[model samples]
Target chain A: MANPTAALIIIGNEVLSGRTRDANLQFLATELGALGIPLREVRVIPDIEDTIVATVNELRARFTHVFTTGGIGPTHDDITSECIAKAFGVPWEVHAGAHAKMAAYYAAQGTEFNAARLRMATMPRGVVLIENEATVAPGFSMENVHVMAGVPRIMQAMFRALAPKLERGAPVVSATVHADGVFEGQIAEPLAAVQRRHPALDVGSYPYFRPGPVRGGVALVAKGTDAADVAAAADEIEALLVAAGGQAIRGEPRLDDNTTAKV
Target chain B: MANPTAALIIIGNEVLSGRTRDANLQFLATELGALGIPLREVRVIPDIEDTIVATVNELRARFTHVFTTGGIGPTHDDITSECIAKAFGVPWEVHAGAHAKMAAYYAAQGTEFNAARLRMATMPRGVVLIENEATVAPGFSMENVHVMAGVPRIMQAMFRALAPKLERGAPVVSATVHADGVFEGQIAEPLAAVQRRHPALDVGSYPYFRPGPVRGGVALVAKGTDAADVAAAADEIEALLVAAGGQAIRGEPRLDDNTTAKV
Candidate 1:
């Protein structure tokens, strides 16, 4: 609960058009949670100038830090950099440091340093560049809004480089207690009671259904900044599942099977 | 494009806390896009009542249709139905029809219709219930805002059942042309030229990376309501790729290889 809030703006027409499933949100969410900065909101908008500018401005003003992915590439649709500048009401121009680094990197790699390649260096005036080891076309951070490549690999790299610079908060930890054969309908009231008992910590009931009559299952998660408190809540939840005749599992269920639905 | 716009509000602390990756947004986007309803914005928000109430109200007012996933189960965390009622300034109560149907179905299945299971029958006043064939706990539609289960299978079923009732819109179609060895930097200018020529159709350059220097690749997509216009623009895009010496492939690149970066 003491964690700093963050918001992500995914600027891609492809995502909105359902051409691709986003891989960034989960990676960013897990990383931010580890950094003790809970991701509060994520907005997936198209590659429209007005939408990008407005979304960036709105989220930046609301959350402690804002991150954007996609539309920072060297293409006509990659207008996130310019739209970000418009959001902050600053001049969009090429950064000398970024330009030098990219030009030298491209030359060494024998990649062309054309006008489009140079567009990667251009950003809002007085911005700090977030370095990406891959492709060398660095993502930049204008104020609190960190602009990263939409590609998952590059986005992860930029995030790691920038993670240390973020403001710290109490690390959020979670304890999962699964009920393999327990239905939510049977234990909803008691789980509500458990939540009321631990007002500071959140008690989440995740119901995972297998084919043929749901298999009547649930995964209860107790999460908070305080270790002892979270553990206590988890214990109470585990007891609840046991009393309700659940074959309780200590850890989170395997997601690879893909049957687990976090209801 | 004469496509109707849709916004999705993913209500879950699990998604925000990084415990679970959301699977509903992409499914909804693809489904809505097929219906000629372009998904304009998607918000992933926490399960907090205030956030849910505020987001539902905001999105309902903006887009032609607003759909919500998650938090509709029979648990303490399942508060989306109540929050939606709050958003509409209506009293949250169990609809007699839903209650009766669920009760009969549970009795037939030899499942206990307990207090928590009864909660599934509750909804806002004057709402039309969206029936789910899988589970007797039907999702409800209040005006333009449709509420579905967070579970992907259940959500998809509910959407299909409700799809026929939705207003028809101009169907959005796409034509994809892939340039496997051509980078965005190489064709950014000419791609812009193609975009300018098309004007109406949105041309997106999706650069895919294959671990070694991006493999200098991109997948150009021309999307719009008009089939002929999209095809013509795609043809021009393919010509542009040919002129740039790209080994142009028709249609979208393999997402199965999991290297396509939808930038």
Candidate 2:
């Protein structure tokens, strides 16, 4: 069976405004890749209610599962929960269990559970609450849509809590063959031939350069669900590099790495 | 007038596959923001032809301008240039200037100008060439859509060269007030009131946490094209933080940054 598809929606004006760099996309992408769920696409959008609602509805129907981060905080800009409710066409109401937990925690701390704080407990009428390790407030899932915190730590915790329940697929494995001095132009033809040989596997030719000294090279990576096919593609690519008169190194290339006699 | 809006389309399967972390989105966002072009949305999709063509067509119509990166190389996986031509319903062919430049560069190095290498010179007909500082290959602009390299250095060079011709809008100014020990629940209500007062500005409340020692806080950021309104909202947020009984700092909070007397 084909791997279940996933999409990520980042609902934040801060990220787009460049005030903050997003750390969640990399984490989520790596985790989802390991879990064998292929992430099809990712959308980073501003914190607009209509945009969030529309994007959520559109992606949820197309992908097997949709995950959203950011704008779930307890402030004026935090409108993701309500927008999600609007997308599902459900009533946005506070969950009894979540409300009780937050109310007790706030009461113990001598803090008032005001309207804004109460918004954390409110979500779609029918949803499953995803547990959070960082705070009493929890993210919930409506249908195939999973809502999580924007903060990297909290989002990770929420994802970890919900990971066990998600459906799994075959994990994609990749192998890399690096030719430090062989630039992409020299090996493009042979690499294309290698790609044609293994149509099912993905062959990627990445040309990399180190800026300070102007030293450069290329890395060929083969990826597929079948480990044997990926391995065979990698071997062929390594041979292709050797035939190009460049030394074939069986790994990824770092920024400072450079070693080849011929151009 | 409102800022010129931009949308970024990152075309790469490696990025979506979680093999490589994307560094271009943050750089482009910050650059576009400084250039008075608010980036409204970003989509990271795999190197699929139809997806690229459709996304390019849809975004070019909705946004003031669109910038795309990756898949414009000399390999089988590099299909961006052709896909863009298909999207615009134009023929994809090698530009004379680009072809001459690449051919001369290869001739100087005594390298064969193979067909795979020639693919880099090909692009959609009737497009302006964007210069590349890192390599001989050039990126191009097709009407409102700007296509650039995926590599950070090359992409930045291409964008810097293209920036002078882009339409600019009002540069967004922002002010941040951080309350180190204050949680969002304590100040959400008052923050919402501040947001209501300054409806023209975007008031964001971000709660931050430090992992090692388990310390957390909140930061309120106010942003808008109008400088005076942003400052006014920031002042109100600082006062609100003070009213919440937390010390208000006048800058952004870093990971190791911790200064608070009370919670």
Candidate 3:
């Protein structure tokens, strides 16, 4: 069976404005892959209500799980919670658990649990709160959609808290073969033939450039649910690279380990 | 008047699989923003033909310009060119200019311009070629949609070639106020008030955490077309931070210059 699919909606103007480079997607991708969930799509959208509502609705319907980050803060630009509520056609209200937690946490800190801070507690009806140990404001899971904070540390914590509830599939296994002094264009045909032999595996060719004695090379990766199939494909790729008069390393070549003589 | 909007479609399975992190979006976002084009949306979709075609069509219709990176290689997974051709309902064919360029480039390096290598020359009908100085394979521009390579250096070159052809709008001006020892939750309300006063400007509050004695702080950014308005809003934010019993720096605080005592 195919792995469960997921879609990540990164909601923020900061990312779109090029002011902030998104760090959440890579973390989520790696985590979800380990959990046997294939993240199929990721949309980095601005802090716009209509766009958020539409994107959330579309992704939630298509993928098995949908995760959102950013725009759930105490500021005016934070409109993700309300947009999510609108998407589900539910009334946006303050959850009792979230409210109590935030209020108590702020009281303990001797900081005012002002109206703006309290806004973080708001969520759609029938939502389960995702714990945020990094911060007081809790993220929530509404059906298959997990709404989390944009902050990297906070988002990681929330995902960890919510991960146990998700349905996992067969974990994907991957193997890489790095070919020294091999141009992707030169080896593309042989690589494609190997991929054709292993129809079940996902084969990818990524070229890398370095500023050293060995200037460039290609990394061939084979990914699939079946370990044997992935290994077989990697073996085939290694054989192909050797036939093409190139030295194929078993794994990714470290930049410092560029001892292979250039062809 | 608002600037022309653009959307970026990042086509690759490697990124979604956590095998590779995307670097194209940030470069495009910064470049487009400087050219007075707001990068409103960015979608990282897999190298699936139907998904690519549908996404390209949707983004092309909605935004003034659309840019796509990845999947334009000599490998089996490189289906972006064909998908783009299908999106525009045009025949996918080898461009004479691209074919000649690749053939000559490979011949110069004493490499055979094989069938798989020639695949990079395939593009949609009526497309203008975007030069790739880093590599021989040329990216193309079909109407407002610019299709480029996935490699950062190659993509950068293609974007630079295409930038001169785009409709440039008024560049956005920005100002920042860094508040030392100020919590985002504490200053959310005041920041909102400042945002309200300058409705035309885009105001954002981003919290930062440091490992040293000065633990936390907030960076208030005011962005807009009007320089004077941005400066005025930034000044107001500085005053508000100072009133809240914190030190407000005019620009982003360099960590080495953080001599200000913690509150």
lDDT of each: 0.85, 0.86, 0.86
The digit string of per-residue lDDT tens for model 2 on A46-68 reads: 88989999999999999999999
DockQ of each: 0.61, 0.52, 0.47
What fraction of the correct interface contacts does each predicted structure contain? 0.70, 0.58, 0.53
- Arranged by DockQ with the best first, the candidates are 1, 2, 3
Considering the true interface contacts (CA pairs under 8 Å between chains A and B), give the fraction that model 3 also has.
Answer: 0.53
* Chain B TM-score against the true chain B, each candidate: 0.94, 0.94, 0.94
Position A138, candidate 1: lDDT = 83
The TM-score-based order of candidates, best leading, equals: 1, 3, 2
After superposition, which runs of candidate 2 have C-alpha atoms over 4 Å from their true positions? A211-214, A256-263, B211-214, B256-263
- TM-score of candidate 2 against the unseen true structure: 0.95
lDDT of 1 at B114: 88
Residue pairs in steric clash, candidate 1? Answer: none
Looking at model 2, give its docking quality level: medium
